[model samples]
Target chain A: MQRPLDVLGSSTDKRIIIKTKSGDSIFGILKAFDSHINIWLDEASIDGEKEVKLGKVLIRGDSIVYISPEK
Target chain B: MQRPLDVLGSSTDKRIIIKTKSGDSIFGILKAFDSHINIWLDEASIDGEKEVKLGKVLIRGDSIVYISPEK
Candidate 1:
């Protein structure tokens, strides 16, 4: 059976859109991740409202709703 | 590390709400699941609309946006 990691390739350069369990929508570039699904994103944004100046942040998998490749 | 199945527990009678990646919101009774996170739900509904007579269905994990205990 294919794993979630397999569903998503290991490239840290793909752009993705994420919706958090708390209902915050985000957009960013995938940076890194672990087995627990914890992820780091560069140039992230929330609800398309403002740019997250840090350009990098880690997201806990438990808070993840869905991750989609940016089209 | 806590797994998704562990996070949800083994109770099949609990009520749950799920938001799919396609954006349909469903309310139902959690029935069963596997490692892939495929889920069975009884009495499921879409967007809080009409009741689903089949009362049972499976949801693939990849399409899941979020799952929450009925609140």
Candidate 2:
């Protein structure tokens, strides 16, 4: 069975869309993640009520809802 | 430092609202959880597009966005 981390691991270095609890979506390239699911992303940008360029960011795990790999 | 799990540990046996990736908020009494954040809840109910009673449920962690203790 693929574990949650395993799924995320597969998406590393790939473009993924992360839906957050604050109702914001982050588009970026997955870089790294820890056991807590805290993620490091590059070329990130907020895509929601307020749009902004976020070159790189480490999103707290709890703030994230789901991570979907871009096709 | 309080980790994500630490926050959840404090909410054990308490009423909590879990926001999920599916855009549903689950109201329940926290029971147990694992490292993966997979949670077991009692008296679980969905509060979103559709409402339903779920006596007991184990929610996969990745599907969860945030867990808030009911005030």
Candidate 3:
């Protein structure tokens, strides 16, 4: 059984979607993460009615609800 | 600065609200947690249009968005 981190590790460099607690959907290429789940994303953007480019960002794991590979 | 884990550590035995990726709001008294953020809650319940008791539960951290002290 793959652990959450194992899934994340396999997702590195792949496009992914992250849902935030504040109801924001973020899309990005997963770059890196720490034990706390703090994530580094490349070409990150706020995904909504209008996608807003955010370039690169570090997302606090505490603020994230879920992370999944973009389908 | 207190890390997310520090916040959770301080919240032990305290009533908290956990927002899940599936848009569920869970309320409970925090019992324990591990490095992966998997949480144990006592007297757990789903809070929404109608409250539903869940008794004790182990919440997978991957399914959780944010955790906050109950207001």
Best by lDDT: 2
Name the better of 1 and 3 by DockQ.
1
Tens digit of lDDT per residue, candidate 2, span A1-71? 76868987788889999888878898888777778687766687778767856655545697778889999
Fnat scores for every prediction: 0.00, 0.04, 0.04
| Candidate structures ordered by TM-score, highest first | 2, 3, 1
Candidate 1 all-Cα RMSD: 9.8
- Model 3 bad stretches (over 4 Å): A1-22, A25-71
Error of 2 at A37 (Å): 4.9
Cα lDDT tens digits for candidate 1, A1-71: 22335423533687766656665767789887765567789988777455455478898876764555554
Q: Rate the local accuracy (lDDT) of all candidates.
A: 0.64, 0.77, 0.76
The TM-score obtained for chain B by all candidates, in the order given, is: 0.78, 0.92, 0.90
**Candidate 3: tens digits of C-alpha lDDT, residues B1-71:** 22336556677898877757676778899999887778899999997778899999999987876566654
lDDT of 3 by residue, A1-71 (tens): 76878878888889999987767898888877777787766677776556767665555687778889987
Better of 2 and 3 by TM-score: 2
Compared with the true structure, model 3 gives a TM-score of 0.54
Top candidate, metric TM-score: 2
lDDT for A54 (candidate 2): 62
Local distance difference test, candidate 1? 0.64
- TM-scores of the candidates, chain A only: 0.79, 0.92, 0.90
